[model samples]
Every structure is written in structure tokens, then in C-alpha cells.
Target: MAEFDLIERYFTFEYDFTQASNGSANNKSSQKNKKPKVVKGIGDDCAIFEIPEKYQLVTSTDTLVDGVHFFSDLEPELIAHKALAANVSDLAAMGAKPLAFTLSISLPEVNQDWLKSFSEGLKNASKLFKVPLVGGDTTQGPLNINITAYGSVKKGRLLERNNAEVGDDIWVTGYLGEAAAALELYDKALVQKAALNHSEAELWKALTQPIPPLKFARKLTKLSRCGLDISDGLTADLGHILSKSQCGAKVCVESLPVSEALVNFVGLEQARQYALNGGDDYQLCFTASSKHRNKILNLAERCQINVTRIGKVQDEGLQLNLNGQPFESNRVSWQHFNQ
Candidate 1:
């Protein structure tokens, strides 16, 4: 199909942001703002976007290539959902409200059914996150999905890796390692979809339809900016926070919250490794003053997500403790080049 014809047939639409559920799927905070303003969208020479006054614009981009990011045999809908969700996860990590997004997709060829499913998947994610798709490009090439997500946050409220302070308690939302475990199972041919048990099914959801904890992150922004989403494993991603904050952490290994699914599949010891080293969890990891412990717990309740206190920020060196003994070793994170 011709590029313009493809977009017109599948991608073009007038989106209604107001009809969307709030960024937090489970609960709505009184302070949650309205959907971001869209000045103009697709079919224009340039898309226009505008947020209300007193908010700073934040943007993030991510690219997914076949074989590297996912198996090419994966469904087009799964591909589309994950391509967009990864970028949205970045926005959540920064504690920003979803504003708009642009997609740049390159497919080897235009298959009608694939395009239909892909567009529907995009629509589903757009509504779920309450973010509009404004403009993007479609081209013919190696199958690739690149997305740039836009967001807005109140001035001086940007979450980042550089603000975690010594004595602050570190917390993470939702279970970790399940997504990575799912990938391992599938890649190793350890299991098949039809044969998946209940716990395995949950792992598959984690691996595929991973949810960004935007609601919990929104609440967290009000309390602190020392936060990020775990795309790489905790040991590696937290290392970025520690390196940037010019501090270190002493994590209690036994405190790392993980789903039973991971343990069932990989056993406790390996599950801990995956929890510490696995990527694609898409859950938020943040730090706040120890005084906010009670408030953080309440916020988690309001968001209807489990938040676990796993460690405390400290000075000098990174340490992992397990049963009163030091654990963790030279950790390696997801790297595109180094690998």
C-alpha cells in the first residue's frame, strides 16, 4: 500500500482525550489534571501541541526492532502495544502527565491485516494512557517501531535519577522479574502458550501488556523526584540513580518484592537473580525521605498497587544484604552496544 493511503486507511483518526480513563487506571486523585491540549494533529505539515501554563514539557523516545526487542512472529497487536507502552513507561518514570506521542514505523511490507491489528493496538494503548497520537511517519524498511512520547509536569516537579538522597528509603511498585522470566521461558522453549499454567499466564501479561504505574508515579511526584522506571534490572537501573545522585544504596535482598510465578518457574535463588537482573518490569522505583513512609503506603493504597520498601540510600558504596550477609556481584544490565 502507498504510505499516505496506508495512513489514511489505518492510522488517521480524531482522538477524544476527554473520554479516556485517567492516567491512573485504578483510582483518580483529586489533583489529576485534564487531558493535555492538542492544537493540531495528523494530515498537517507539522503537528502542534500545547500544555497549560506553568508546566514544563518532557519528551522520551524508544525504538523496537524485530529479533532484538521481540520475536518477529509475535502478533502485530502485541508489537504495537509494547512499542507505545515502552515510551509511556519513560514518561511515567519522569512523573509527567501524558500529553501526546508520535510514531515512526517502518515495515518490510504493508499487510492489510497486520496494519489493522497494529492500528487497533495503538488505539487501545492511546486511550488507556489518555495520550493522543498527533503525527508520525510510515515507511518501508526493516520492521521497526519508533515512538516519541510527550508529557508535561508542573515546574520543578520532574522526577529523575539524580535526586535520591542519603537516608532516604528506596521503594518499588508492583512485582518484578516476571516479565524477564516469561521471556526466558519463551526463548528457551521451556513452555508453550497453550500449556501455560495460571502463574505463567501472569508472567506472559507482565512480558506483554506491562502497565506503567503512572497513577502511583503521579502521587510520588508530589512527594519526591528521585524516581525512575525499571527497564533494566534493579541492580543496573538503581546503579544509574546511585551514580547520578553521587551516593550509594544498601538493599535488603530478602525485601525485593517478586511474584510467586517467577519462583515457581525459576526457583527462589534464580528468581532473586531475575528480580535483580531482569529487565522490562516497567515498574517504578523511587526514593523519599524516611518520614514519608506512612504517606507512601497510603498513596500505594490509593493507587491500588503494591509498593515495597526494599532498601535505604547510603553513602559511598553499593551493598546488597541477604540474611545478614553481603550479596550481589558485578552486575550487567541490558545494553545495546556492549552486548
Candidate 2:
């Protein structure tokens, strides 16, 4: 299919953002939700959208390249899903509601089957996240997918990494290390050797189709002052928070939340390594005042997300403690250039 024909067939859709009911399947009960104003979408030279009153636009972009970001032979559908999900994860980190996104993909060759599957996955993710595809470009080149996502957050409620205060309790949403374990066990032949049982398939799913805690993040905007998604592992990503806030932290190694699947497959110590340095979990890590501990816990319960208090912000430098004893490590999170 030609470029325009491919877009018209697979990407084009009519969405009335003016209607509160126009959203993804996961948020059906959010019937009274408000949508941003969109004046023009795909088919135009540029998308024109109006930001809601008192809301600031939040935008983030991510790019995934074949062979580096993922195996070249991986499913096209999974590639599409991960490409968009990574960008949406940034929105979640910012405590923003997704509005729309643009996709720019480069292909080595036109394969109808691959294109069809990729487009379907993208569309499904769009509906699932309640974000519409606004506009994008398709080109002939090495396999590459870049997505720029847009979202909105109310003024003065935006979360930032620099806002963490000393003595604040650090929290993380959801279990970690599963995606890293999945990466370790991804080779089919190594799966059995890694002791990955049938029940642990969710780890693979977590690696492929990570769901950003958007609702939980939104709720956190009101309760927590500093936060970011754990895309680069807690050890390194939390370092970002510390550097920005000009503060230090003491992470309790035993407090790291390791999924049962991971612990069963790799044992506790290895799972801890993954949680600390393996990266790609995409869960949110934030800090709030100790006074709000109960409120944050209640919010987590209401949001149906598991929030764990892993540590506390401090005055000087990052340290890892295991059962009150200092732990030593030379590990760091994933760095695109180095990896």
C-alpha cells in the first residue's frame, strides 16, 4: 500500500473529543471526563488543539530502533505497543492525562502483514490509553519508530523531580524487576533454564505491554511533590530525583518490591539486582511528606495500585542499606549510549 493509502486504511479515525464518552475501553466509567479541544487532526499539515483553561500542556517523545531497543524479529504488534507505551509512560510520570500523540515510523521495506499488525496495535493502544493519533510521518529507512505524546495537567499541580524534600518518604507504585527478568529470560531456549513457569507469563507481558499508572499518577500530583517513572531502574532514575532536589536518599534494599515470579525464577539476590539496575519497569517513583503516608496509602488502595515505601529522602548522598547495614554496589541503570 502507498503511504497515504496505508494511513487512510489503518490510521485514520473519527473521534469527537468534545464528547465525554469518547475514550478508551479501560476508562468506560469515566463518562464524565473532560477532553481537550482538538481543531484538526491527521490529514492536516499540523494538528491544531486548544489547551483547556488552567491546564498546562505536557509533551514527551521517545524513539525505538530495531536491534537496539528490541529484537528485529519481534512481532510488529509488540513493537508498536512498546513504542507508544514508552512515550505514554512519560506522560504518566508527569501526572498528566494523555490527549493525543504523533507517530513517525521508518521501514526498511513495505510488508503489508507487518504494517497491518503494527497499525492495529497502535490503534488498540490509542483506544486503551484514551489518546488519539493526531498526525505522523512514514518513511523508507531502517526500522525505527518515534512517538511524541501530548498530555495535560492542571497548573501548579505538575510533578517535578526537583521538588522532593528532605525527610520525605519515598514511594513506588507497583512491583518491579519483572520486566528485567523477562528480558533476561526472553530467549526461548533459556526460558526453561531460567525456571520461568507458565504462571510467570505475566512478566513477559509486563515487558511487552506495560501499562502506565496514569490514574495513580494523577492522584499523586495532589499528594506528592516529586516523581518520575522508573524507566532506567530505581538506582539511576532515583539518582535523577536526588540530583535535581539537591538531596540524598537511603534506599532499604529489603524494601524493594520484587514480584513472586521474579523471586521464584531468579532468587532474591538476583531479583534485587534487577530491581536496582535492570531498568524498563516503567513504574512511578515519588516522594511525599511523612505526614501524608496514610493519605498516600489510601489513595493507592483506591486506585488499585500497590504503593511501597522504599526509603526516605535525606540531606547528603545516595546510600543503600540492607536491614540497617550498609550495602555496596557498583551497578548503574541502562544508558542508551553505553548499552
Which tens-of-lDDT digit does each residue in 5-101 have in candidate 1?
9988888867764443334534445225534466677878888875545678899998888988877687778778888889989999999988889
Model 2 lDDT per residue over 109-216, tens place: 888898888888888888888888999998889988889999988889888999999999999989888887787657862335346465367788788888889899
Candidate 2: where is the Cα deviation over 4 Å?
20-35, 189-196
For candidate 1, list the clashing residue pairs, or say none.
none
Q: What are the models' TM-scores?
A: 0.92, 0.92
Clashes in candidate 2: how many?
Answer: 0
Point out the worst 10-residue segment of candidate 1 by lDDT.
22-31
Mind sharing the TM-score for model 1? 0.92
